[model samples]
Target: MKSALKKKNLVVLKVKDVKRDKELYLHQREAMMALDQSIIDKENNRFAGLIVLPTGGGKTETAVRWVLKNFINQHKKVIWIAHRRELIEQAFESVEKNAITALIDKRKHFNCRIISGEHGSASTIERNDDFIIASKDSLYRGLHHLEEKWLKYHKEVFLIIDEAHRATAKTYRKIMESIDKNAKKFQVIGLTATPFRTAQYEKGLLKKVFKNDIVYQVSLRTLISRGILAQPILKTLQTYINVAEDVSEEEAQLIEKNDTIPPDIANFISKNKVRNNRIVQEYIDNKDEYGKTLIFAVSQTHAVVLNTLFHERGIRSEYVISNGTDLFGKGIISDSNKEKIKRFKENALDVLINVNILTEGTDIPDTQTVFLTRPTTSEILMTQMVGRALRGEQAGGTKNAYIVSFVDDWQNKIAWITPEKLYVGQGVWQDCENNPASFRRLLPLKQIEQFAKIADDTIDTTELEKIEFIKTVPLGFYSFSLEKTNEDGSTFNKSCEVLVYENNKTSFEKLMDKLTAYYSIPDAKGAKKLAKIFADAEDLSVISFLASFGFYSSNDSPTINLIDDVKDIVSHFEINRTAPPYIEFKEREQIDIRGIAQKVYDMELGGKKKKAYIDDVWERNSFLQAYFNHKKLYFRKAIDTELLKLEEPELYSA
Candidate 1:
């Protein structure tokens, strides 16, 4: 007995050492460290926390590695729970693969069962079954089976919930409660990309479920910058499908409040032949640019129409829906959805259209583009749809992914979740025309919308110009202009833009208020108060505030320079002294308006056409019109060529 026990201990140590030596990405390493710490510092032998990682950031692999080392190798049981079928299958596959590498001891036998409505049963959960991958519904229904076979016997058990943003649902809560009551020692960890809840009640429930404990969190920007996830380039294709007249008041209210349109409206959009044709045409036009694509359709009919259209155009495409029937009640395509997905993963199929099936937990890392043909106001659904193509080069995917959204004219009724929301607070922008090679950055959708409005001749510019641009600052952005004297005694203007993410806006406002108050009462006591305020402010808020004054540094201990005018008020306040330990500062050049204008004017349009276009945009772009109207002389040279054409059109006639 002693010899056998010693051998078991040696196996466990061997597994731990092997798993430790395995290479983990920087974020994954940090997550593992946090999980280990959570386990060690758990109260009552129980720990519940959420792991927030963006899609394709390998949250599953990280959890599997940690569980294999800590639970499976130590002869403890683990129950991996997910609501979706794909999540359950994906979890099972990940654990199965990792277990092979970590659990090499033949003497130690372990078994895994997949319990879901379609697959294994909870009643068959054996005493020796070490790992269980189950759907929440299946596990909830079979709580008695789990309690009788394993929960009552095992003193320590680990519960991992995937797509855990839905943990507040009744089914999930019931399952967790049942397990808590049955098991003596319980630890629960939830994994999700979006931790935030839109509804107030749902937020409260989520907080209660996880004790407001987020063990480890990594942002989408962090993953992209670290090459763990791809940069998402948002492209909007206008479908020209106007359904405003078809919508009822009740439908509009439902869309605005619930983030869902009426079924009849969805069906109407799905059957629009013109809109369907445009979707297929986009794919055909950009076949080479958009390599392996996944399309989210509005309905089964929409998916079938798109798939048939692609096939008619001699493109390799397939569509999958929940049911095995076409819109006409005919049988589905010869190949099953799973088989089609397999072919898509193998690169045999260029495009795979689905109706709400591939949104969550379906791992298609090689998808280079995603066609969001269906409009949604739900941020969670939008995130999941876009995340399908977010796998990075380091993770065996491309460096850049394209999120092509089919935008329709909704008469500004529904506040749809555009692809720009992903980078609203991320402080990343890519001007494709200016810097095509730089995939790490992203241009905000608001800017794109502004430009589109300027170019749209149908929209009356007179009404648009009346609206104040100041009232509509892009989300998470603050912009101001500063003029500095050059060595030659001339002044050059620089536009300063700072990004205060949505989550940090409240703190940023508070910091600004405190600074404003301190400016009114400039004294050593006020300086101390300001210093305390800065200390309490979030790091991002402090960075944004400093950035407002042209101090753009990302260093841990950056030396901040105050403007000459505000020096007296903040003379006693040590800006550098209040920076957080992890604050990074990097110098960035300010935007040169003249240079940008020159580049815009350098486009291929002829003199007369360019002049007309510039004049049209000038009248339409409210912000530019306002600024240029006030400082017409200052920026006259920037648009001199266009103005010259207007004065002497005969000299430069098309």
Candidate 2:
């Protein structure tokens, strides 16, 4: 047995970490920079904020670098909090290993103590082991292991929460409140991909936890198209009418606590031998393509059943579920389950099924396919589930992941988990409605698969002369601006935004509705229900991003001319009364052929505000890009020409 001092704490740190910090991907670097800048903006004052990186976006590494910058060697106490054992373990191991080896700090003393339960380390707080890893459950059980005076030893404290969406849990709140009411905590940093922002989640919890500070977000679509994550191809496998209708009212209302599924839904989903067998056959149908598969089921019994079905079909399979024999009832993840995951990672098992075991804080990128035997409507659950396969080739992934799901709207009314939730026309989130696109009603399953193939870049559909839109979706109206000048030659700008509750059809669109503040200027005050005003008018690039990557969590370009369509919408909704205009504040139409031309030219040298004009042109021209092309070639040229007139006034007069 290895000595306690020398024993590896599941993760071993070496010179590799020093190398790891230097080898950040561009996106990871951007995340680090964003965090760093946010901190700098705080002027070393007390600050709390979040870093939004999609899973597999190197959140760990970016966090490592950020912590090293602020938390290391300052004689400061640091606490990293996580709820799950996997996350707690992963955090301790990664931070410890990376700190010892990669940081390469002058101070050789560094230590990490894992505090979870009655029998945690009782060793004295040495200089080397100031960082503490506390499971929230451990804190709730007892505070005996930690002394009140000890909290004051460090001049400052840094609290970093992993899987931070859950940081507002009751236990977490108690711990944070205790700390906040006490000593000086320098900052709070939350790292998460799926931030719970719903009205239910937001209910004054997350804001209190993070102080509602600046938020930096990077979407999964941005990372995937940039080759950072494995591309996902989600395909729907519709369930039969009988199977869909069989989920009883009780089953529909089933809930899970600590991943223990309610008995009603567990039995309902697992006992359906027909659905079980169908899902198994679906797995086998593409077994050749899916080298390693993850089967997520509704409950433990359900997972066990799926495991048996896979084995019955001669596929190597294993399963680990919650409610293990441990006191916390989470032991399945301790030995038996961990072994299965280890074997799966080693390629010894072809398939692994579980009841929400690998949803978050577990990284297994080799999962080439995800079988969604369990459905969910929660974006948090689905996002974490799909993220299992989104890790890119750099992290032992195949660069391609498939989500195989079944859609029966009646069976699972929670819109969060259905296959149809992904049907965004042109595949953009901003354009998404709560309903499935009308175009989907026209295509068969196989044709839908073809569309997914196009999404994955596995095939090209440009050769198809015409897209057969057999059905038409009713269009929502939005106002537009044509940049028209009045008869007196003064520029007039007109816009109005209105709020409507599509609660009947779009209650889930709540999150994006927060865009109200951005577009609602005080001057445009009215009943505030104007259909003409839009919050996302200036930031419409998100439309393109959605078209390319679908919803960031779940899953287009249009046929009509974009500008023409906008004009039509604007014309329809716009109240066409030109505002009175009085100009003559500005100078001449042409550049003066006199002095100051050199001054303007000199301003374009570099780092000038006006230099952005030419730079903006170059930036837009770079958009021969396929993902969310926000190219504005003519706009850039116009800005450049105007800037040039300022630079060469003499030539302008000529």
Candidate 3:
């Protein structure tokens, strides 16, 4: 019996070994190939670029493999830098695990050292250390030590920056500059899920550092299609907690400026029994579906509260926070956090609740769902939180991951990051069965917020109460009805609807210019002459032009099909069409016009520049000018109000 059991154990060990020797995914291999080609190109000696892979796409593993094969096997020195301790440790472990077993030369010996606050210092970095996995903070503080100890001897080194979106930061830049000045031959490689920055200056800095090279890139949609990442299903549960009303102007400004929720607001949210109950109830209601869940709490107190609630309800749950004292003044250490994470990874714990600790660099691939119990304005932080559960079947995770967002009514005070925004252009709407209608179609959040502001400024509350409010006109489509004085002094309503695909303002401007010129001409002879000139010069067709504009009407189709004939064109314009009631149309039109003005006014431009831009649009864009001319009083008011808001926000607020 003992001999038979030994044989079975040997078979299991062999199977595990075989699984460990599995090849990289096709996309990962492509990334490696791109990296190899870039290294050999030799066009630029200092080749620096990014490997952009979506979360759960094994960016670190791909990079490690490439480095191991091309650099480590060649006995070259490499520095792997990450912002967080977890990432530094992860990189160290990855290199250690694959260095001996997976490398082409198994006999090659390499020393790997981790430099961080908790780990060893720069003084410990020996000359023979081939690989140094380091935290940016630790390296920045110990730069002199590094230079005196190891950097002075090693003039040739390769740098790999994990979570390289943050490479634009001051610490990262200073470190890179130091290395550049010290090293004789060096190459930089950045690995990141998000390669783009929010600010223009930051983006420029990133381009300057990476030499504007995106050597390899892959989209979230492509990864999901290739089964490299799980399909993310976003679900929002409204907490109905109105924190905006409780926030002061100072707090609001701080939140906006810092891109974080204020502690007072977070504390208030954490203490809300109703909100807590709902969050706990949600998990209890869907425990089976959620499976191994992770919840992002606003604070340590929130995590503790949620964990306690889950325990009360007989659920296996644990909360991990930074090494500190808990709410009850009990000391919480890092080891406890690691233990909880370990249990959660092993499926011993059903749920793991944390406060900011699990946002980045933590490998929790088996996480089936993430409950976003906190609100944040930072896109980077939001992306990190959402990435936790993105691992797919090919990555040894589930087929689908659920992103459950506990949404609060912020009352437009904070521009919260939504999961839908991450996959904006990634064809999330293409799969109808997987994504519901609510998740499929969405106006940009900025547009929605601007529309709300316009509604507040334009709509008469008492008047609105009398009738059911109609949905705002769809973006990129404008409709208006003009009351025109006929040639015989009789009155008639001329209705016009303009549809510009995807809000193509340039195309609309061209159409507007053509219409303005035709309408400005008084005599039929001049109109005919101008029409002929336009047709002959531009080869313009009236029907095709209108079709290109996405123009259509409920009442009548265009009678004129060619721009060469002036009579048919004029006849077509003269046809009466069914128009919305003039008063209602004007009211809606005012809101939309003001909304557009506000959007322009809110741009990150100086006052003079903004005013100049608005003037340029108003003068050249005939469609906008026509609307503004009709409602001159409202237009002037909107401009003055927006200008006041910009110049003297305090006065405007009052």
Candidate 4:
């Protein structure tokens, strides 16, 4: 066990140091120099601590350079620790070049060797080994039985922790405490991109374990501006349906406490025939356009259910969850299963889905769309999630990244990140409504209620088919009256005509009558008369009300008094011209997505009629042409020339 432990230590330090030496890239010299100085300053004694860096910033290479710069002359053993063997192997490869044959032949020093996690005895008993790599599991597994002799000789041990966020946990903390107790002279260092502990973990424990402050951090915005990372574009899918009061007070409290939009919210997002069918059938329908897409859920259970739903829909998608007894042997792909992982990366599967696992360090370069089903408040998580799709390789066929999130908590997260911090389109949050696109009509609960009633009556059509037809109707409108009283007991009554149109149509003759009657009704007596009329001829009440203004939520019965209170609120509406949903801004050096896509498409198609969805270009270029007759968006060589510099930098030589 002692021999195995020593060998494991050497592999961790050496193999990783070498792999990084090769992979390490631009602007890392200063950081490496600083880390090297820190190590040299604490040469003979114990060193255990943390190095903080943002996600996408290179922390792995910093640790590698420390080993190369400090340990080359001393020939002292260095130990690297990680929870997983894949990380150990990856680190081993990074620093592999640091290994040399001259020292091995002279019997004075051997540069590095990896200790296999599967076999504990890969370590050979050798003195003056420069570096070692070992997974924490391999070390902890053999700790009790490790030979005392091996522990005594390893005086110059350096511990490097990778993905140091987990370092605050009980197991790692215990192991480090044990190491400190036994070793006379040992040093530890930790590295992680996101080190903020979750609410469950005790606070201040991380600082206690890793005593060093973060000396350098490269923010996400900086990474994008420097062309090292992809810029993220924000977009959302919203549900405009009103909530039902059929929910219990307990459920309401739970929803409120958690700040979550209820299951009704999910129902609304899924209500639109296009959005629901589009989400489910996206993989098969757009297999060519979207080679790979990722679906992120808030929890593991959600991941499983969503995965199962997709599989049932005959979409080739899989979900990976890492915990629970039921998951003992299912879906947990071994880290060493390179062939399987490689196949997924190469698009053998239409989508490779996992919650949290693929978020941080797992690199899958071809991800084109990210579907966010869960709302997140963490800025770090939002950045990491969006960063997955924004990366583009040179000449990598035009990259079009898509994000489909519900717009509720979205604005909250956006508030944390600055407008200048954004990578792509920038303007204001309210500008989204100005875009020509509008979501098709599909009121989730009402539609679901309709289908449910039809199903109960033994209907011939499937639920999805009924949903499709309802989606096509020209208008859907519901009218209901409510009597609202002030706290002072003077009561005022209101009649509301809730309208869900076939398209985004807001004008209809029948809708005008309902509005006229609503305006005419002054008191509860008139409201009662309207209510009786609605009850007597439910279908007629709807048809009559919708005939003028072509709007409808239900074709069968328009006067359905569902959620009268909510209906009352909508009826007494006031008109205010507010800003649209999403707006973005950026500087000149940054790439403009619409600008790049339009220029590329126009050049390919050679016509203006079949222009792609360039909303801003259409607005600006048409204005430019009308006023100046220059036809600026229609292919001015100067504009295209500037775009070429932004879109195809390598092809656009100075």
Ranking by lDDT: 3, 1, 2, 4
| TM-score for each candidate, following the candidate numbering | 0.50, 0.49, 0.52, 0.38
Q: lDDT per residue, candidate 3, 1-654, as tens digits?
A: 223212221100110121246577889889988987888555345778899987557788899978877787777888999865446656764665566445546434666667775565676667777778887877888888778777889888899999775676667889998888888887899998754532333234456678747889887788887766788877766676888887877777567545567778788999899999999999899999888999999888999899999999999999998876432122344887889899999999998999767876568888999999987755556767887888887787778888888877665555455676444434452332123222212222332333344446565433222111122232333333233344543223333333323234344455555544443323345446545544555554554555465443221211212242322333332221111111112223333444544566667655788667766656654434333322334344455555555555665332
On TM-score, the candidate that comes out on top is: 3
Q: What TM-score does candidate 4 reach?
A: 0.38
Per TM-score, what order, best first?
A: 3, 1, 2, 4
Candidate 2 global lDDT: 0.52
Span of ten consecutive residues with least summed lDDT in model 1: 579-588
lDDT of 1 by residue, 247-270 (tens): 776677567545556778788898
RMSD of each: 15.8, 21.3, 19.8, 22.6
| Predictions in order: lDDT | 0.62, 0.52, 0.63, 0.46
172 Cα displacement, candidate 2 (Å): 11
Clashes of each: 12, 19, 0, 61
What TM-score, to 2 decimals, does candidate 2 have?
Answer: 0.49
lDDT score of model 4?
A: 0.46
Candidate 3 deviant stretches above 4 angstroms: 1-26, 37-50, 72-219, 248-260, 311-316, 325-349, 359-364, 378-380, 426-504, 507-654
Q: Is candidate 1 or candidate 2 better by lDDT?
A: 1
- Candidate 2 vs candidate 4: the TM-score winner is 2
Per-residue lDDT of model 2, residues 130-248, tens digit only = 67776766764444334354554554677788767566556676776666656565678888764334333332445556664436777767776766677777665555524435545
Clashing pairs in 3: none
- Count: clashes, candidate 4: 61
